[model samples]
Target: MSFANCGLPYHIGGDIKDRSKLLLQTPESFLARFNVDVRVMNEVVSINRADKTVTIKNLIDGSKYTESYDFLLLSPGAAPFIPAIAGIDNPLTHSLRNIPDMDRIIQTIQTNKPKHATVVGGGFIGLEMMEHSTNLV
Candidate 1:
């Protein structure tokens, strides 16, 4: 399932309340409604523009294959800017990006029960996190 990624921070801070509400679409729904074959766990490793083909990697089974396409749409999403700093690799340090990252952050808050938290970025999402983190205190 693909989620409304912008709502991830709100979901973390209890503003979203319902986790399922974040899910925006499913592969089956896309296939049924739009006839789009949404391959969830497949990654396009390489694109051959000359031949109009793409090399796909199955993330789950570690298999690789190529598929020819009339038109290719590249929709790789953004990643957080993790600065190179001391102790940045520590398990406590987390970046909010995808569903797994959000899950880890939530699990850390619940299981570790830390008294304090640090938000790195000062963008809109960062401010939302800071406000929500304070509310959780």
Candidate 2:
């Protein structure tokens, strides 16, 4: 139901020496702990409040299906906001919103080995990125 250790990339490097420590819960652990079906890599495309149903698409094969529910809780998190700046779309610039984004940022830092990195926001996520980036230096 959730990416358990989203905050992990901030603590671990690209090599990921100890995956067990980083992984907060596995599918088996989650099932045993909460007795809930965990669906991973599925995207909720639409919700029908009238019928109390949600339409979800399998991210792997692009196949979609619908499921009825008595109640639905939507928790679509926010994406990193990139301002309309020149060269913001450049390959060198990166933002950390998900695990992939964090991986790419780490890869860029390791490969390029930049002396300085500029984090735009002073928010929690921004501060985390700044801290991780500082560790690389």
Candidate 3:
């Protein structure tokens, strides 16, 4: 997620049109290069702070596992934050959170061809999310 949205800012800067270079680090590269061990598609269902342990499961597979950590970093830059609309979910709305959400937004736009999208929150993250939809940016 950190390096995935790299190309969107360029839209604001008017640098490039497409954003293929933004998604440079795959799960393997993020893990191997940074030594961060990025467990792709994994959900942290529970966190035991006292024990310094984290419980996770892969979204693709139902396998469960636990990891011990000396310290934890919580930097989920975005989440599916809806504004309590009457029928927001009915019209296929979304927010940027992870790699899967990016894919979903891309696929939805490709299949539905959405036009005149109304992005609610106006901030850094909202800008990033909206800028990314421009030709799969």
Give lDDT for model 2: 0.73
lDDT of 1 by residue, 1-120 (tens): 688878888888889999889888899998999998889889899999999999999999989999999987777867888899899999988988778888998999889888999888
Worst 10 residues of 1 by lDDT: 128-137
RMSD each, Å: 1.6, 2.8, 4.7
- Winner on TM-score (1 vs 3): 1
lDDT of residue 118 for candidate 3: 64
* Candidate 3 overall lDDT versus native: 0.68
lDDT of 2 by residue, 51-104 (tens): 989999999999999989997887777877889998899888987665567567
Instruction: Give me the runs in candidate 1 sitting further than 4 Å from their true place.
Output: none
TM-score of 2: 0.81
Q: How many backbone collisions does model 2 have?
A: 0
Best by lDDT: 1
Clash count, one per candidate: 0, 0, 0
**Candidate 2: regions farther than 4 A off:** 1-9, 12-20
TM-score of each: 0.89, 0.81, 0.58
lDDT: which is higher, 2 or 3? 2
